[model samples]
Target chain A: MQISASKWLDIWQANRRLTRRVIEAFPEDQLFSFSIGGMRTFGDMIKELLAVEGPGIEEIVTGVRQKFDEHASYQTKHELLDKWDAETARIDKFWADLPSEKYLERVNLFGQYESSVIDAILYFVENEIHHRGQGFVYLRSLGIQPPFFWER
Target chain B: MQISASKWLDIWQANRRLTRRVIEAFPEDQLFSFSIGGMRTFGDMIKELLAVEGPGIEEIVTGVRQKFDEHASYQTKHELLDKWDAETARIDKFWADLPSEKYLERVNLFGQYESSVIDAILYFVENEIHHRGQGFVYLRSLGIQPPFFWER
Candidate 1:
């Protein structure tokens, strides 16, 4: 069950690619405003997801902590997709220099979630799958078929 | 991040516990037939998830390949929960015996997906999270509040 930090970077990148496709599937109109029952819209979910990456990983790579923020960036679907792509490249740049053994060491994620870097890393992928699931629901409700999960 | 094979077992088990709570949130009558739109009912999604573990991990451990089967088990929520609990324990029993190094080696999952055993193991959790996201939508549409994502 051990994953090298490089392999984890690959895994994270793959999932992020799939998530980008999920964002693409959204009708721009419903991306942020539609909600099932009282649940938050896909936009809000996406924002929360975007917020988790850059700062969280930065904190791990550097010992500096940061507060989680989802509301400050990207108010539109186009902007979110751009931000997602940029974040993808950001990880590509930072992930390579990250030592695999560092994943085994503890990192205080966002100064709130305190756990091993591996656990925090897993949380990134886990959170995406969860949010994408919500997006799938949103798409189906709007009569759109999301990109197939296996395509990733 | 390096997760010993045993620690992966713990991580998987913790996530399973949360998923079980999600199953518990479903109204007995709606667990099987509920859908957000044209999406498969949460029950069918659950069955696909149930099919992945047990036999999948067993194949990794015993080197005896088992075909994927999602339709052959469970006709009711009662049976499903029982199966889920049993599978949880089954993982506990077998997961420890799995060599941590095996996770670094590749295994063709259910004769289709091929990757390192660690990737396949992560898929088990990722797939469940995806389906559970659908379950969340189903619950919300039915006027039920689903379990919180972070509870895991």
Candidate 2:
């Protein structure tokens, strides 16, 4: 493998840290309501991300699948952040149970989206980066300097 | 390696195709002037992608570095798309010169960022995905649906 499973975890964690900062940068009011070009607000985007990672890893580890849902709402930024932090811990715990060899195994994510486990995980990361990019623009439009993209 | 170098190239090309569709979706006038929340026009974002990939790969292949520049202007969307197609070819050509082993080598990209050649390449893809996400919002704001992210 070009990268060990643990190395990939580290990379994903770095990206998660940067994403946490993006969440922090948002003003509470704007986090859920401020969106440009008709895109979902940053808060909603976070919900989609939150819906995927921990549960996805848990499914991978347990050989179980759940319906994908991104509509679960948080009433405030603080609640959302708390959920995000909890998901992070959940992912770490499930990740420990995932054998590295399982990364090469194919699985149907969320009872749909069949792909190798690694690809599914990559999708989780890629999807986050994609939304976070929008978050970056959202911050910029608000005249805020988003944390550097490379800092991850 | 978890993925072969050729596989990475194929992945990048798929992304390039989607980004091309994004460029096509833009109205010529809006492509250059449209902004939401104070973000740069989509045209300017394309310039940065153009500046990075071909030259960055060339540097990796030739061991010669040049100053990064994203200021080169295009008169129309057609011209920018042409540049995009040309860079696609350039990346393919340079990619051929890069040995699989070289992916693990570290090089300073544009005399600034430093990382393994693979990470640098991953950044190129990740960066494109990032910007493309912003483009999705731009298109949605304009009421045009961007290409499906998963199609890549």
Candidate 3:
């Protein structure tokens, strides 16, 4: 394998850690309201990420498909962070349930995206990084310094 | 291998194609002058990408260290696109010279970042996606629709 399953997971977790820092850097008031160029707010983007990872892993572990949902409401930044923390643990559990061979299996992710398990996992991380990049701009525009991109 | 080296190269090329589309979506003048919230212009980001991939691959192929440079000035968007096209071809040639076994070897990329060749290559793609996400915001702010992220 070009990369072992564990190494790839480690990379994904590192990215997740960086993303969490981006989320924490946002001012609470701006978390949901701030946006540039009609883009979705960082808060909305985080919800989309929260919607995907844990449920996506669950779907991968079992044969059941998940409906993509990004409309969960977290009335406060604290609430959002709580959910984010919970989802991280849930993802670890679901990920541990995934067999090594399943990494190569083709499955329909969220009943929307179709690809090998590996590709789907890669997309999950890529999507977060893309959104996080936008978050970085949002932070910079607000005169705040974002966490270093390579620190992950 | 979880993914063959050729398949990984194909993925990188696909990302390059999508990034090229992002570059094409920008107005010539705005390509260098337009940015939101004090971020670097998408053109500058493109130059950084141009500085990395081809040279990074060459470094991996020959054990040569490259000095990271993003200071090349292109007077027009056409010139930048021309360089982008040339780099794509150069990256392919350099990539072909890289033996599959070398994917697992560690080296200092740009005489700065040290990691296995595969991780370094992944960083190249992730960095592009990161900047492209910002470009998407720049385009939307300009009332121009950027290319779809998943089309890559």
The most accurate candidate by DockQ is: 1
Query: TM-score for model 1?
Result: 0.93
Cα deviation of A22, candidate 1, in Å: 0.7
Better of 1 and 3 by lDDT: 3
**DockQ of every candidate structure:** 0.76, 0.59, 0.71
lDDT of each: 0.82, 0.88, 0.88
TM-score for candidate 2, please give it: 0.94
Give the per-residue lDDT of model 3 (tens digit) for B6-40. 78888899999999999999999999999877778
Residue B117 of model 1 has an lDDT of 81
Tens-digit lDDT track of model 1 for B1-152: 65666677777888888888888898888887777768887778878888898888888888888889998557688888998998887787778678775767889878887987877888888888888888888888888887888887
Residue B4, candidate 1: C-alpha displacement in angstroms: 0.9
Candidate 1 residues A55-90, lDDT tens each? 778778877877799885567889999988888887
TM-score list, all predictions: 0.93, 0.94, 0.96
Give one clash count per candidate, in the order shown. 0, 4, 2
Off by over 4 Å in 2: none
The TM-score obtained for chain B by all candidates, in the order given, is: 0.93, 0.96, 0.95
Q: Clashes in model 1: which pairs? A: none
